[model samples]
Target: MGDLVYFLNGRKAEKIEAVTFADLRMQESDIEEILRSSIDMICDDEESMLIVGQQVKNEKNGRSDLTAIDNNGNIVLIEIKRDRKDIEGRKEAFEFQAIRYAASYATLESTEDLVKKVYAPYIEKYRSEFELGVLTSYELLIRKLNEFLRVNKAGKSFNKKQKIVLVASDFDEQTLSAVSWLNSNHVDMSCYKLTPFKVNDEIYLQTEKVLPVTNYEDYYVNLMDKSLATIVKRNKGGTRRTLPKIDSMLDWGVVKEGDVIAVKDRDNEGILLANGNIMVNDKEKSMQSWLKEIYGWSSVQTYVFAIHKESGKSLSQIREEYMTQQAMEASDDF
Candidate 1:
């Protein structure tokens, strides 16, 4: 059956009948409006989520349905599709469109800049309609944006991650398979089905996350982590390394060819390395892998201070000196 059947009180005379978006005269735009106002219906934490932009134009002249940023600074792109009987190839079209938007959004560098441009306009458009007192929506948006930015700056890195969400009345088998494959590979995509029903004058809506089902969410996350770790390890083998530069300031001045260096942490040192190879705790890992293991995210620059057993100076100090020298050399080139 295309509709979900409901019975009242186990065997009551009342019945809840299935309703389509058309029956309610609700368009995709109406659904978008409702979602913009109540995003938490889809995202778990409403307080930490902000609908920054809607109908946002991308670099390729395509407009995205909604753009939001979570407290973690991860950008979320949402696309809405109406699955009507008249529509054909809706699955492929909607999925492909959302993926394209995601690809374009992944290039965004500064979350602050995006907030100022896209979110500012959205707040301005809806400010007068909000009943939340004298504080304009724009002002509140900025306050939330600043708070998120501050917290993210002090904590683990953000703004580099992007997730795509597709909302529709129903998903086809092909679309489900595509989303499943993407989520399995750590692409961070999800599909939510918004089914509508009616019982007399009351209209009820049901939301279900079709992709990466709740029962398997933990398993999926763990699998993705392992897969990422494996990829990092494989890439480490191909990375080029430079000879260890010796500093003469310390008593044990030089870094020996086989000395082990550790990434500092309270419980887990992550990985110990000697001569560009994993020596302890791990089989093959690089600085990037170590950072991912310790911080649960990948950063271009390593945050931990690597220390050599012989030298008193921390790796941070050595890196600072090296950077300073490189800056001086670059000035000469100019």
Candidate 2:
């Protein structure tokens, strides 16, 4: 069993007593309630994520624990299993259910579709519990969704990218191996073990990511990138386009030799230095490497905005104008 024991400071190490949920009379519903109320406690990026729906129904007539959208526009499906023993007989069942929900969610075409289909039901179901005279639940939800898109500049379609989070008190070897393999292949899957411990009168919850391991996260991310690159290459006649060199960007006046540029899309972002080296989420990379790392395909273009260290223009504004100019030039060429 997963647990934590308190230690007393002394000349000799003394093992303080520790207790489990059974001793405290805590139930599965308690964990679920805590998670549902404050999901950020478990999500990887709380600032960029919005929990838009709960107990969402899948096409299979089953309910998903929670559904969220991140700033990158990736759909996040979270499933919670109260304790290690609770998943004994139904280990595969939870995985299958999460997969079904992901499959269904992958069909969503746009954020609007998500708001209308997934979030609307949640708003309506809980409308009465919210405060009035301010924004209505529906309006508040839309504002939150739009704000996320505006801040992230994530344009709609999250169907292609999905993240599945499986939370349980403990995961057996079988489930851990399965999720680890899936994460390495192409699925962005994570398993979190939430263990509860009690000492005296206080209860402490410990959450650990048991799958993929924290140190190996980048390795799995690279593997998934390679897999996606392969898929993109295969789908596009097995040819990968070369990204434009830094000189071209400089000549086009999009970026100067010493300027820092942020290349972004609805789901990801990469930073390019004036010296031609690129960085995605702080990891140094080359242009082609960053493109492949971010979008899986070089031909898949995204918004590139020059960051002016001394200017008042926002990155989003810069990106918007750049896109507008590109659209106009494309129209003229057409």
Candidate 3:
């Protein structure tokens, strides 16, 4: 649980203090919050759902950082790095090292072969349990992913989510951004941003959405001030270019082409999107319903129709056009 609090400068900052996952196990109550938040990012999609952290163990060989058991009962390798050191130099190298560890251990022709070859005293400790759990304060995400693939037999299946997550007080911006960009290309993988905050001298952890939430279409729309498509497109680039038309800009499943979305009435003003989430000046039916159904049609349709005809193109298309026009005028700031 993260809370927002004023710092010495009255600015906000998460209070991690001396907490570090390397010294704590996932089962610890304090680490549970970080695990919950970080796991959300790793399990953002289906492939990631079956893959989890602390399910892997790493040999003391100093070569491998962590190890995990994939769904298929195979081995997955991992490496942890949290330093700002130039030794590793490249992020991809860390990922590749884990792959290499798995590759080496993968030479076993079968489960029996794996037992005879890679399974050491330590690995055998958890062999009967059929899973390994490892945590490094740095980043064990690479292991999380490898373990997921092994557990799920990813390549053999058409499944798409790659489960992996890195938990830290503040991770490297480059790695975070890269992981984010990669996450957008597929739903199988995701990342989470955990900001620890202290409010009234109490530390709380807050979970922020990093990927586009399909269910809360309106909520995200309002939060990001962009249409669902725009949000999805920016994160997950795909060929599904179904932009909405002008009149259907306010219709469900449509983008209004504007960068920002706002809802207003006589008394209060609020911002909105397709998801049922919002930020409003006041909580009122006029405001709540409008925010909840920001892209929906109702009595408001009459006014919209008076301005623009249905034309049989579906409300989505019409709304898209209108939104696009507004979006263009608003610029890309919002």
Q: Which candidate wins on lDDT?
A: 2
Candidates 2 and 3, the one with greater TM-score:
2
Candidate 3, 53: how far from true, in Å? 9.2
Candidate 2 regions exceeding 4 Å error are 5-19, 45-47, 128-136, 214-334
Ranking the candidates on lDDT from highest down gives: 2, 1, 3
Candidate 2 residue-wise lDDT, 1-334, digit = tens: 5255555657656554445555568776677667766565564311245667788887768788888876577888988876657677674666666888898998888767898889888768767644435876667667657766665567654556998989887665556556756766778887777777665666777765555543333222343244532322233211111234455555667566545554443344445566666666677775544543443221222223223333434343554566689889999998
lDDT of each: 0.60, 0.61, 0.36
TM-score of each: 0.57, 0.59, 0.32
Q: Candidate 3, 326: how far from true, in Å?
A: 25
Question: Which lDDT tens digits does candidate 1 get at residues 1-334?
Answer: 1546575776775656567887789998999998886665575311245577889887778899988876567778989877635234444466678889888877766655776667778767766643446665556665656655554452244567888888887765546556666776788787777888887688788776555543322223343244532322233221112213233222233444456565543244433333343344546665444543443222312322355444545555665566678789999999
lDDT-wise, the better of 2 and 3 is 2
- Model 1 TM-score (2 dp): 0.57
Clash count (model 2, backbone only): 1
Q: On a 0 to 100 scale, what is the lDDT of residue 93 in model 3? A: 43
Question: Which regions of candidate 3 deviate over 4 angstroms?
Answer: 1-41, 45-60, 63-65, 69-99, 105-109, 113-165, 176-192, 199-334
Per-residue lDDT tens digits of candidate 3, residues 1-334? 2223444535655444433333332222444334423332222111123212332333635344333343334343423443223214665543344444555554444433333333343334434433345643112333434443443455343221123333333334344334444445552223334455444546555544343333323223244343544443345322112243223444533433222333322122333334422334444233223422442211122122112121434233455566677789789666
